[model samples]
Every structure is written in C-alpha cells, then in structure tokens.
Target: MFSIFSLIFGLLSVVIGILATIFWIWMLIDCLKNEPSVGNDKIIWALVIVFLSYLGAILYYLVRRPERIKQTGQ
Candidate 1:
C-alpha cells in the first residue's frame, strides 16, 4: 500500500529515531561516569540532543565533546 517514497521516509525516520535514542543514552552514561570539567556544557548538549532530535544528537556527538576542548590551565 505504500509508495517507494513513503517507504524510504519511514526507514529514515526509524533510523534517525533509533540513533537519537542511542546517543542520548550514551550521553547520560558518559555524564554519570566521568568528571569532565565542562559538565554544564555536556548537559546542555545532551538537552539539545533530546529536544532537537536526530540532527541535534548527531551534532552533539560530532561537535560538543568535552574531552575535545582545550583547557588553558591546571
């Protein structure tokens, strides 16, 4: 009953939804386990992921990891 485009969109939605869910879960685990200095930043990224869905989650993983940031002083 579904057209090809419909099927494609359905698949895309499922994949995106799964990816977002997994990313949020991983972010939660990471926050709980680590004492990263940028805790607030990480939490904000996690909220952005949850609220904005797939693209936001992907962006959080790609762009906002605390370990990737440079610290200026000890």
Candidate 2:
C-alpha cells in the first residue's frame, strides 16, 4: 500500500487542492470588492463563483475579470 507512485500523486493532489482553494478565495474576494454593483452583474458573478467553485473562478479569471478591469479601470 506504500507505492511511490501513490505517494507522489497524493502529494500532487494536495498541492493542487490547496492552490485551487487559494485561487477560489482570491477570486471571490476580488469579485466582491472590485466588481461593480451596477446591476445584477456583481450578484451573478458572486453566485457563479460560490456555486461553481474552482471552475467558476477559472472562468471568471479567464473570461470576465480582464474586460471589467479594462472598462472600469478597477
């Protein structure tokens, strides 16, 4: 039960999990604070992040944040 491959994969999984958690929290905070409450945009993004978690965070980071920052100068 002590295979080297298992150990390596377990460690890798832990690291990835930690990183994903950090990114999630970071994105959540960024959205809450920096994302404008112009209408329902902020609420929708917050919901997306909360419900979708890491995948949501990745989506926001890749899809929306850049454009918002550019448009709003946040």
Candidate 3:
C-alpha cells in the first residue's frame, strides 16, 4: 500500500543510513590509524566516534582529519 513517492523516500532513507554507517566506520579507522598517539588523541577520538556515532565522525572529518593530515602527512 506504499505510494511511489513513499517507496522512493524509503529507499533513499535506507541508502543514506547505509552511507552514514560506512562513513562512520571509515572515520573510526582513519582516526585510529592516522591520529598520532602522542597523548590521548587516538583514544579520545575513538571514544568520541564510538559514542557520538555519525556526528562525531563528521566532526572529526571536518576538524581533526585535516589538521592531522597537514601536520603528520598521513
């Protein structure tokens, strides 16, 4: 009993969710691998990503990843 628009919206939602999950996982791995473990950065970022989910990932991608890559070239 789903209309065409409703069906399309549902599919779009699923696709977005899947993409968000992938982004989240990718950020987590990138943080763990590329984030320097000088102090507690890696642990802190991992915790933030784990607790905040996609939002944390987005934050890290926009904020720390650029700086880390620039500083460490990793």
Best by TM-score: 3
Locate the minimum summed-lDDT window of 10 residues in model 1.
65-74
lDDT at position 13, candidate 1: 100
Clashing pairs in 2: none
TM-score of each: 0.51, 0.93, 0.95
Model 2 TM-score relative to the real fold: 0.93
Off by over 4 Å in 3: none
Model 3 over residues 1-74: C-alpha lDDT tens digits? 56988999999999999999999999999999889889999999999999999999999999999999899999
Better-scoring candidate (TM-score), 2 or 3: 3
Q: lDDT (0-100) at residue 5 of candidate 2?
A: 88
Over 4 Å off, model 1: 36-64, 67-74
Q: What lDDT score belongs to each candidate, Candidate 1 first?
A: 0.63, 0.94, 0.94
State which candidate, 1 or 2, has the greater lDDT. 2
Worst 10 residues of 3 by lDDT: 1-10
